[model samples]
Target: MLIGDVARRSGVSARMLRHYDALGLVRPTGRSHAGYREYSSKDIQRIFHIESLRSLGLSLREVRRALEDPSFTPAELVADLIRQTRERIAAETELLTRLRRIDAVEPSGWEDVFQIVALLQALGSKSAGKRQSAALSSVDDVPLPVEALVEAALSESDPNVAGALRWALAQSGEESLALLAEGLGSPAAEVRARAVQSIAEMPNDGATTLLREALTTPDLVVRRHAALALGVRGVADAVPTLIDMVVEGTNDVDAADALSALATRPASAKRIATKLADRLAEDGVEPPARRRLTQALADIPGPTASKALTDLSHDEDREVALTATYILGLRAAR
Candidate 1:
């Protein structure tokens, strides 16, 4: 076959075949009497081999080494190719995500696109201050897609940046609730906790509903955060988990404060008091936990709480008795 015929059949252009010949990658095996290049069957086979290697992202130099070097080992080269491919794929995926986020914003012009891109880059910047500034400024001009805010909120490790991201997500109202709800089911414990915390900042009813659903999650951190948010919203359903938080010593102070907030309601105050008293009466209740439970009851009004405190004032544990007595005195002073 001549060069043109080989180019036509093998899909390698004639120009590339000549370039390959110049590089000694593939040379025609013979010449015609007219001095034109001619390819033998084996030469065509070598061209096919070069094309095959190139398909696997091999550079021309690597392809030359692979085809001609007797000492070359394929294992290391193949592993390197795999690593490079992975990196390319990761870069492409990040680009696709950013493009989708930009598209979701419905940018009005090139200027809007540029602004959104700048904000996104800042959100991922290495400096915590930059990330926080980006989060705070997200809603200033171009409205960033709620998905971006939720993703940032979930992955942010810096406390200030995380708080800013959560605040930004809250400003998106109920739009971010769905993504944050999915975050609640993440296999990562930290992600679930972040999800709950972000949801806590959202003031809409949809966020409240999700927070209520999170009350029974198996993640202790998620449940505690959800319960505290619900307590802030005056949701009576948070009372049980808030009590559990007091017993477990996980954010027990905030849990007690939430319980106090809930107890301000006449309808739920007695119920909250009864639940705390019951926890204090449990057989294996530790002294520290029991003390926390007693302190929690101090803020709760209604006769049930008073009667529980009066009974606790004479308890066998000295600390518990003194705490109950001090609370009773405070109540008397009131």
Candidate 2:
């Protein structure tokens, strides 16, 4: 086969085939009597091999080494190609996401497009200051995409930046609640925690509903965080989880505060006191945990809480007795 025939059949262009020959990658193994470069069957097969390697992201130099160097091992080269291809894919995927966000901004013209682009870049910047600035101003001028704010809030590692992003999401809209709720289902525990925290900051009824649902999720961290928030919202469903937080000693102070907040109504105060006394009565309730529970029960105003505390005032644990005695005295003074 001649160069043109090889180019036509193998899909390699004639110019490329000549370039390959010049590089000595694949020279025609036979020549016609008229002095033309004529390709033998083996030469055409080599051209196919070159194209095949190129498709796998091999540079021409690498392809030359792969085809001619007997000492070359393919394992390392193949692994390198895989790494490079993955990097290229990640870059392209990031670019595509940026483009989609920009389009979603519904830019009126070049200026709006530039503004969205700048904000996106800042949100993704390496500096925490830049990310926080972007988050703070995210609601400026053009209403920023809520999805962008949600993404930043879920992935942010810096506490200040995370707070700003959560604030941005809160200001963004009700749509943000759905996105943050989806983040709760993420496989990563940190993302789920962030999701619940962000949701906790949203004051809408939808956020409260989501928190009630989150109380049943398997992630204990998420459940605890959601429980704390729901307690502040006066959702009675958070009572069990809040009580658990007290016993577990994780954010027990905040948990106690939430419990106290929920105890505002006389009926709720009695019910909450009953639950605390029950947890305190459990067989395995240790002294320290029992102390925390007794302390948490002290803030309730009704007869049930006072009765529970009066009983605790004579408890076996000296510290529990001291705490109960001190709290009971305060209640008397009031």
Candidate 3:
């Protein structure tokens, strides 16, 4: 076949075939009596091989080395191609996510797009200060999509930056709640904890609903945080988990405070006192946890709490007895 026929038949353009010829990658195996370049069947076969390699993202040089080098191994080259392809895919995915976030915000012009892009870059910054600043400024100008704030809040490790991110997410109200719900179900314990903490900052009904759901989650961290949030909202369902937090010594003080807040109501105060008394009655209650429980009852009002306090004042453990005595005196003086 002549070069024209080979180009037409193989789908390799004539210019590309000439370039392959110049590079000695594929040369015409024969010449016609008319003096034009001519290719034998084997030469056309080589052109097909080069095209096949290029389709796998092989550079022309790599293709030449692949076809001509006797000792060339494809395993390493194929692995490298796979790695490169994965990197390219990751970059494209990140770009697409950013574009979608920007579009979701409904940017009014190029300036809004540029501002949002800058803010997003800052949110992902290596510097904690920069990230915190970005989070604080997120609501000032172009409203960033809640998804970005939720993403940042879930992964943030620094305490100050995490607080800022959580605050930013709270400002978005219910918008951040759905995204945070996904984080609550994440397999990573840290992510689930962060999700709960962020949700705890939002005071809306949607956030309250998520916290109620989080109370049922198996993660103790999630359950504790959700209970605390629920307690402040006057949701009595959090009462049991809040009591558990006190016994477990995880954020026990905050849990106690939440319980006290709920105890301000007449019926809730009586019910809370009964629950505390029940824990005291449990067979395996330890001195430390028992003492903590006694202290928790100090802030709760009503005759049930006073009776529970009165019984604890004469307990066998000196610390529990003293704590209960001190609380009784404080309640009596009031």
Candidate 4:
């Protein structure tokens, strides 16, 4: 078959066919004696596969790699491609839903928009899977109906629509929690941090467990966010972990946040102050470690911490003395 026949069967233009051939991605099966290109049925089949993969959102490079590597299973490649597409679609759908919800309301349309707003709020509270399904169910084909409802509400100036948008923004679900758990494995540290933060907002034993597990992450950002989340959740179970972070974590911000969280309880405050005082009194404690311990003690803000800081005011390190003095001043104010 000629290039025209390949184009017709593959639904790709002749020019793109030549481009694919030039890239060595779907070469012709044979050549005529006159030096013309010749494609066999096998070549057409290859083109179809390439097109199918492209439709599924694989880049040409990814397609080429999957095609050229014999060890790469087609099913695995397709599955990965599908997952990527789903993530993209999910993000897009969320953005569209927000936009539509904003546009759906009218001021003069109804005396009370509370019912519609409540429904939208309930919809938003559902898991992402449920939300996605609800959005899709409202439309014939496109996934924009939820957004359309929002848009209608916004346009009509309905108070219910405004309430719905706020509710959705605050919505939490198991699916969202699962998405966050999956993000913990992302290569980006920021993504992992955000995932942990989101999970902390929702009330779930599983979510808390995931946040606790994140405390052990090698990434300081992830560990920092986990500590902050644990504090926000006010989980007493996390106090020990947060204390460890204050004692040993590389990130000062994280340590500060953890110490602040731990300071909320008198028992925790006393415990942390005692630990810091012991560290300061140790002959073998390094200067830097000692300094960090002093800073954490000062941050705890109590009689025990203030007393420890006052004693440290006479230390050899001028910075430590100054910090201790500052802590004394802060404690005096209280």
lDDT of 4 by residue, 124-234 (tens): 543544444443333222222234333322222223433333233224335345545676887866556555555655576777888888877787767666777777676
lDDT of each: 0.92, 0.91, 0.92, 0.66
* Candidate 4 stretches greater than 4 Å from native: 1-170, 187-190, 203-205, 236-254, 278-292
Per-model root-mean-square deviation over C-alphas: 1.8, 2.8, 1.5, 14.5
Scanning candidate 4 in windows of ten residues, the lowest lDDT window is: 136-145
Candidate 3, superposed: residue stretches over 4 Å from native: none
Clashing pairs in 3: none
Worst 10 residues of 1 by lDDT: 139-148
User: Which stretches of candidate 1 lie above 4 Å from their native place?
Assistant: none
- TM-score of model number 2: 0.86
lDDT of 2 by residue, 38-75 (tens): 99999998998999999998999999999988878899
Candidate 3 Cα lDDT to native: 0.92
Q: C-alpha displacement of 333 in model 3, angstroms?
A: 2.3
TM-score of each: 0.93, 0.86, 0.95, 0.45
Better of 1 and 4 by TM-score: 1
What residue pairs clash in candidate 2, if any at all? none
Candidate 4 overall lDDT versus native = 0.66
